[model samples]
Target chain A: MNSTAVTGHEAATHESEPGFYGTSWQKLMMWWFIIGDAILFGSFLAAYGFSRISAVNWPDRTQMFSLNFITVMTFTLITSSATMATAVAASRRGDRKAAFNFTMATAVGGLAFLGMQAYEWYHLIHNGARMDTNPWGAPAFGAYFFAITGFHGSHVASGVLILLITAWNAKRGKSGPEGVELTGLYWHFVDLVWVFVFGCFYLI
Target chain B: MSDTHAAHVEASYRSYWIAWAILLVLTLVMISISTKAFLIGGILLKSVIIGAWFMHLKHERAILIWSVVAGILFAGFLFLVIHFDAGTSLL
Candidate 1:
């Protein structure tokens, strides 16, 4: 998985080398990084799951959350994942304009999602929900809620920055197809992670 | 880079839109499907579409796909292990 493996394609130098495996080394590394991230988030969610199930007085998340807004945020992320797909696809076809446009749309979607998260957090905090304290059934309720969601949100924030930078590179014609695809993979992973987080915190 | 690259570079735009619509519908259905089976089904559908198609894992090398599968399996194992001792004191 070293950078040296990609000598076949001229584009490999700037974007990534095609590795021992069929995929690019950088792309493979991104996949591995995401797998690690999945484990981290999975552990947190698992802990939260057990904690809530074991606790006698776990608060009802459905009632605690204003579902409409958070639902909007989730949809925004879903949209971003789709746009990211198109961006990578367009980049692969050498459609620079379309790739840049779709990538920008994805970044904007990420930003909108963050804005919604911030709004949700502000009201949740103002309403006396804290990682340390809440009138809810157990302190663990507030604790895991913020901890897990914040961890996921931070990923989204960074993902948005990544998309912005990637989009900028694409606009400048400096990004390779592999680079765009790798960025899309990261973005979609973020969206997929949110699915579980949403299920655990809201639907469950 | 090769003739078999298939969708390595371009994908069906319509499929992406269809996947997005499916996700939106599933989210709406989330409110009604709290049962364990439905929950698992929803997650599976969402995960497959996003991972297999949206993320283009379907065309990736076996090493990458298997590693990700291993990661998910391990995560599931974690859930199982924690479920057995879910409420044990964290501190």
Candidate 2:
């Protein structure tokens, strides 16, 4: 890692003067953001779990959540993470066009995931699910469900916009490789958080 | 200045594909474990895959990686402290 920011040419070298604990300042900041975000998501999940484990008669997941829809959404997000990872690798390899394309595909994946979420939400709302209400007698169920998934959906929305911007800059050759890489990190963190959310909310 | 990653991480599209495949398999395992005790295990496996491969945390600086570990611990701490306030199933 050189003191200079990574450019298209330097990205090919894959050599680094680890700026801050093996990454650039921007990259470090992204990780810090993720850490903070993780804490918040963690607390919400914990609250949901506590509500769940203590239930006398909880609505079973099969009845409350649409497994097929959520499973597809999970795949879409995971595929996006793969694309984001590929984009980072491409940028590191100095293939800006390939990197830009991969990132674009990642943004598409985010859009696809959001589309699925919207469809699911519309269907659930039609079935009488709301922030504070649900068909299930346990009103707390709807509250936590929407709270957790809604929060996650918001992150995915932000991620899509960030990816779009990163993709646009990569196309224009305006953003440095480090910038692309940091954005990629943020994208993956969103997916990472969703992993647990899926497990806690949908599976278990 | 020290690079946290091995100079030769062999970062490539091939690796990304491999990670994606692993994730899909883990998802399958998780969904199947849906109501089982291993559901939590499946979740942890998925997270490890994403953090190590997708986030490239495996090649990141020790401090960065440890920061993630610290974050997980902090989350665990949060749960432990908050569980008392949540309702109980004990009859």
Q: Say which candidate scores most in lDDT.
A: 1
DockQ numbers for every candidate? 0.60, 0.59
**Candidate 1 error regions (>4 Å):** A1-20, B4-11, B87-91
Q: Please give, for residues A110-147, the per-residue lDDT of candidate 1 as tens digits.
A: 99999989989998888899997786678888889889
TM-score of chain B of each: 0.75, 0.73
Best candidate according to TM-score: 1
* lDDT (C-alpha) at residue B17 in model 2: 89
Candidates in order, TM-scores: namely 0.90, 0.88
Off by over 4 Å in 2: A1-20, B1-11, B84-91
CA displacement after TM-score superposition, residue A130 of candidate 2 (Å): 1.8
lDDT of 2 by residue, A40-138 (tens): 998998878787776766677788677988989999999999989888877666678988999999999999999998898888889898777677766
